[model samples]
Target: MQRDRNQIIQAENSLLASYAVRQDETGVREYPEAEHPYRIPLQRDRDRVVHSSAFKRLQYKTQVFVYSVGENYRNRLTHTLEVAGISRTMATALGLNSLLAETIALAHDLGHTPFGHAGQDMLSDLMKDFGGFEHNKQSLRIVTFLETRYPSFPGLNLCGETIKGMMKHGGEYLGSHLGQERKEEGPSLEAQCADVADEIAYTSHDIDDGLEMGYLKLEELSDLHLWSDSFLKVKEEYPDLGGKVLVRSVIRELTNGMVSNMIRTIESRIHQWKISSRADLNFHFQEGKRIATYEPEYWEKVRELKSFLYRTLYRHPSVVVTSDRGRDIIESLFYHFRKQPDSIPETYRQRFETEGLERCVCDFVAGMTDRYAEEMAQSIGFKSKEA
Candidate 1:
């Protein structure tokens, strides 16, 4: 006999720890629907996210560099995939819901603006009087209202837990879609894993990208405790490693060390607190205790590496020039649409009556890919800042 949804849930439950989210308790949706016969709720949520148009747009979105910078650089789509892979590995090791972790990771960056942080910061400043803009809230907005697919629902109508997990930066979302109630409780172990996974993927991969782009040097990075430790280990293991292979090997070792240390640290916390159920986890969460984190000494090294990247890679002239162009495109588009709302797609134009013109314009601009935004800006008679 074929395994049905109930059988699958049972299997999942058997594998999950007491503190992990139970499959049965999840899947509460805004628009109620019948459960699938074969797939569990989280699996269905993952599929819905994967199928959404917003997810597809990530392919052209920036991660650290603009999409046009290079074919091999990590775009938002590749970064999301890497986060999902790392989160899944961490969740499985901790006996948490790996599927939930992966789903959250997949949907985490669906609302990132075209030029990464540069676009987001510009949009935020432009919209400051209009309630401001943040990617996390934008992500929630996309899944809840922006994405119009189903005839019965305006959004994907993903599971409640999936939505909550996607709110990695926890705070109050102003819109009625998420309500005004302040969420004080911490997220589940799966959500924490996904959040940290994002950190690990970006920190290590950004180093690789910096090296590849010639913006960062190996000698400069050797001063970082985290990089040096990993570099030494990689060099000891592969005596002849050089060039791209050497960089990749070092990054792999760095990633591996971070993941292993994070898992071990979280496991130690779980035992130290004697957390054996969801209720126990909630109790600690209510007490403002963080269950998932690296040891302080190790975390200091990670922070050092991040600070180095911020100073060296992110502030590089080539990257700044590209990001500045992207910001100009976004800002130009924002003003253009504000002046003539009709230029926006009819779908977004219709939102003007209900969500106000500025917000509708912001939503439309936020959804554009890097190249598309540039194209649209040119079509609107806007010139590059450098031009």
Candidate 2:
């Protein structure tokens, strides 16, 4: 059951080792190679990610709630863990690489700033010259340079498919779509799973978080097409399956829902557009064609859930105010420092000389825990130590 580099290398046209070559603000991944007797290749990949420092950093980074508000609200780390839980489940059910799915889930947001997307937007504007910025790509960078394991190497040395998801995980922002040619990497089925896995977790957890925070009533949450009734039925029948109990199964069910929806949307769109062949997911190279659809009624319910999260969970006044401030603070910091990375703190400065300024800046930001990043906002001259 044990598979190694030579084994995996022969299985694919190439294994993406270059990503493991970059250094984080700390310099290198500090992992030790171990000979496991019975772990599969992808499983090994998953384990490496969970053990990496960068993966641990996810805890301190942003999720829906800012890190400080509530200990329970998902932080980047918790979010990653949840994503992995659901991903492994899905991957296992589908007979894909459970480890690969889990690895991608854990590393998906490694590049997110201490403040989440708000922080990424700011850095992207500043680093537009340094090929811009991306959390997925940064996740790739984390395993490669910052995590520190392979003495002879810098990154986790993951597979090509894993790296591809890290590179192109979100929106179809093809190279140069936003002004620069996209990284010379293609999409893979694994990345697709990671992307879908994120959606599944976010949709379900945000509601759970909403309920936890007292913003959503269970009745409100369960008001969907069979979804609400089904959730209630499960709660009523199992009783014990309440709270975070069946979260994984719910997410698995949600994945099926979303996938089914996407299938219908694609099919309907194809017919509407007069397109032929089910090649939208061209890279998937699917063999058997299975019919899937998101029931219109269910779609409406999902939309309602999505809207509720946006308005209640994401757009809560307190959260919005802080996130808005977060956006401003991070943007200001990146703009000034991108021009003079030497302005970065001494620990970061010494590191800057090796990786150049932009990356050094990215490392400085990415390395921060939520509280520390907000506190350090002052050193860069973006307002004062006092908010």
Which candidate leads in TM-score?
1
lDDT (10s digit) by residue, model 1, range 113-170: 9999999999999999998999988998899899988999988998878887877545
TM-score of each: 0.97, 0.70
lDDT for position 313 in model 2: 71
lDDT computed for candidate 1: 0.89
Residue by residue across 47-144, what tens digits does model 2's lDDT show?
77878877777787778778777898888887787778766665454434555567778778877787887777777777788767777667666766
lDDT of 2: 0.61
Candidate 1 segments exceeding 4 Å error: 175-184
Clashing pairs in 1: none
| Candidate achieving the largest lDDT | 1
